[model samples]
Each structure stands twice: as C-alpha cells, then as structure tokens.
Target: MKLRSLLFVPGDRPERFPKAVATGADALILDLEDSVVPERKPEARAAVRAWIEAPREDGPAVFVRVNPIDSDEVAADLEALAGLSLDGVVLPKAEGAESVAMLLDRLPGDYLVLPVASETPAAVFQLGTFAGVAGRLAGVTWGAEDLPASIGAATAREDDGSYTDPYRVVRALTLFGAHAAGVPAIETVFPDFRNLDALAAYAARGQRDGFTGMLAIHPTQVSVINDAFTPSEAEIAHAKAVIAAFDANPGAGALQLDGKMIDAPHLKSARRLLALVG
Candidate 1:
C-alpha cells in the first residue's frame, strides 16, 4: 500500500472511527495502547473488532496497535485480532528481533508487523536490528516519551514544542536502518497538533531524508504530511525529461539539461522519480 500518512484513532472512541475513515489518510491505525486506559481496554478491543468485522467502503488501510507482546494483554489481543481482517499489527515497545520473533510465533504469518522501534531504554540500542524481524515486517518507528521516562530523562522538545536534536537523531538513524534493510521507514508522529508550520517542516525533513511516510496523531496534519512526501509536478516533469533525453542518446554517458551536466547518477535519480510517477 502507498501509505504517505497514517492517522491514529483511539480505539475507545468508536465515535471517531467513521470520521477517521473519511479523513483521506492512506491508513487508519486503531490504537489500543497508550490511547486507551486500562479499565477501557476490553471495551476498546471489542469496538475495534466490531468495526473491522463490519462491511465498509473503500476506506484507508486499517492497522491495529495492540499492547506490547510482553504484556499480559498480548495473548488476548492476538486471539481477538486473529479472527478479524487487519492490515497489520503495530507492535509497541519492541526491544529487538526476538520480540518480533515471539510475535511471529503467536500471530499468523500473513499479518504484517510494524514495530515501534523502542519505547524503553534497552530498545534504543537495538533499533538497528529491527530489519532482522522476519515474517512480513512492514516498517519501524520510534517513540520519545516512553524512552525518556525509562531512562529518567526528559523527552527532547524545543521551546516551540518540536522534537529536539536528540529525538531527531533517533528518527534519522531509524530511517537509515530501515533503508539499509530495504523497508519503508515510517516516521513517528509530531505531537504538536496546533503548530502546523512545525509539523510541515518536520514532514518535509522526513521526505528529504528518504522516509516514505509518517504517522499522524491528528487528521488535520494528514494533508500536509502527504503533500510533503509526494513528488511535485515539476519534479515529475523533470524526471520525465531526463529519461527522455537519456533515451534519445542511449550511448552518451552525460549530457546537458537546462544548463546543467546530467550524468548517469542524475539520470538514475530521475528514473526513480519517474518510477514513482508511473
């Protein structure tokens, strides 16, 4: 699926499910963890299952963020979802490849896995190994709040409430690792819903750094994130032109295009863009 922006909806709030499905997000993540309180877990799970079981329209892809595999609720969550139609399971507090392996042992192989890179201190170091998680592992993402609390350090944020350098470094490293492993690097969410400018800048940065998509905490942020990641008309046109020029001169290693030297590498980049367009 071409998921440029995946929005999260609290599982307990079933009233928001239909609205979320209509938000134009590439995917809708029905969150059962962090968003739903302990007392409401059972109710949330029931609501999510009911929503998934019912027939629906051509809505966004649906993923369920179940509780951590290590938690007591893991088995129940798995049993509940195993009988339903879900695009994937967003595993929270994933420590290493073993955590994914354990889940694979329990869940069916057909289900995709999107692990939240690390929410605990031990997980920060193991982020590199996320690619090793086999069995339809879709992508890797991270959370700042849990990690900081695990280490007794404050989560990094600027005066404007944007993620600080430390968190940005983690996000970049996760993206690099995902690329190294040849998976889409799904970016973490920007919590500041009110700061549209900051959110746009963050999404743009993710696109520039090779991230395929980002998770959204609010529907309002979906359009900006999707726009930042998609190739622009000018970019698409330039890519087509480069390919056309190369096709017309197949033997040439380099050629002039708009006053600039277009070499093999430039042509290769252009071809990738054209591929995206097609």
Candidate 2:
C-alpha cells in the first residue's frame, strides 16, 4: 500500500479521528502509546476499539500504535484488538525480530506490522534482524525523540533541527536495515509542524536518501509528506527515458542518457521508480 504519509492521532481523542482521516493522509496511526497518559490508557483503548469497529467506507487505512512489547499493557492492547479489522499495528520500541515474533504469536492471524525499529539503544543493534520478519512487516520506521531520552541525551537535534552525529547514525542504520529487510524505510516525524518549509526540506531529504515514506505528528504535514514522496513529472519522464534507452540498446551493457553514463544500476533504479509510481 502507498503510505507516503502516516498521520498520528491521539487514541483517547475519538473526536479527532474523522478529522484525521479527512486530512488526505495515506494512513492514520491511532496512537495508543505515547499520546495516552497512564491513567487514560483504558479509555484510549476502548475509544480506539470503537472507532475501528465503527462502520465506514474505505478511506485512509487505520493502524494503532500499541505500547512497547515490554509494557504491562501490551497484552491487554493485543487482546482488545483481537478480530478487529485494521490496516496494521505500529510496533514501538522493537528490540529485535523476537519482538515482532512475540506480537505475531499473540495476534490471531496475519496482520501487517510497521515497527519503530530504532527507539532504544539496544534496538539500534537489532535493526538487521528486521530482514527476518519482512514477510509480516508493512514497513520499518525509526524515531529520534525516544532514543535521546532513553540514552539521557539533552537533545537529539541541533538548533536547526537537524540530527546530530549519533542520531544521524541511527537514522542511517534504520534506512539500510529497512532496505535489507526488503521493506519501505519510513522516515520519522519532523516534529516541527508549523514550519512547512523545513518539513518539506526534511521530507525531500528523506526521499533523496531512499526513504519511501515519512511519519507525521500532525495533519498539516500530510500534504508536504505526500508531495515530497510523489515523483514529479520531470522525474517520471527522465525515468521513462532511461528505461527506453536501455530497451533500445539491448545488446549494449551501458548507454548515454542526458550526457551521463547510464548503466545496469541506473536502469534498475529507473524501473523501480516507475514501479513506485504505478
């Protein structure tokens, strides 16, 4: 499924659910974890369940961000979601493939999973293990907010909101790990929703670095995320040209395109870009 933008909605606030769905996001994550206070967990869970069970026509695919696997509430979270139709679950703070396995074990049948694979320090080392669970994963995403707090860092971002070296490494690992896992590497939320320009730049950077999608904390970011990820007409045209060049010169291993050498790798990328648009 195309998840160029996955917008987050606080699970306790069912009044905002319809508004979130109407934001034109490709998917909506009803967050039952971080957004809910401990005292309101039960109420949030009930609200999410009711929303999921409510009759509605096809719109943005809905996913729930359950609490961490190690949390005491996880079992009840899984139990509450039993048999409810959902697009997927955003598994947070996943330490390893074992975490995914444990979640699958409790769930009744096959369900798409999008794991936040880099939230804790230990989770950084376990990123590679995601490849083993690719069959069940819709995509793999990473977060900068939790990791800094987990490691007791004062801040994960610089004054300009760019990640520092340490967090940069984590982001790269998440990207490469998702590639290794044969799934989309969704970029984490930009956090500063008010600065549309910064958000656009951040999303553009993610796209340039091979991220297929991005997470959004607010609805205002959905359009920016989607626009950034979507291939422009110029890009599509160039990709088509590259493919045509290779096809026209089948016997040649390399060809010239726009005054640059187009090789097998370029051809592969062109095909992949076209496939994404399709």
Best by TM-score: 2
TM-scores for all predictions: 0.92, 0.98
Please identify model 2 stretches exceeding 4 Å from their true place: none
Q: Model-by-model lDDT, in order?
A: 0.84, 0.92
Model 1 spans > 4 angstroms off = 251-253
User: Pairing residues by index, what is the TM-score of model 1?
Assistant: 0.92
Q: Please give, for residues 94-200, the per-residue lDDT of candidate 2 as tens digits.
A: 98788998888888676899999999999999998988889999899999999999989999999988999999999999999999999999999988799999999
Model 2's TM-score against the true structure:
0.98
lDDT of 1 by residue, 14-80 (tens): 9999998777898889988999988998999899999999998878889999899889888878887
- lDDT of model 2, residue 148: 93
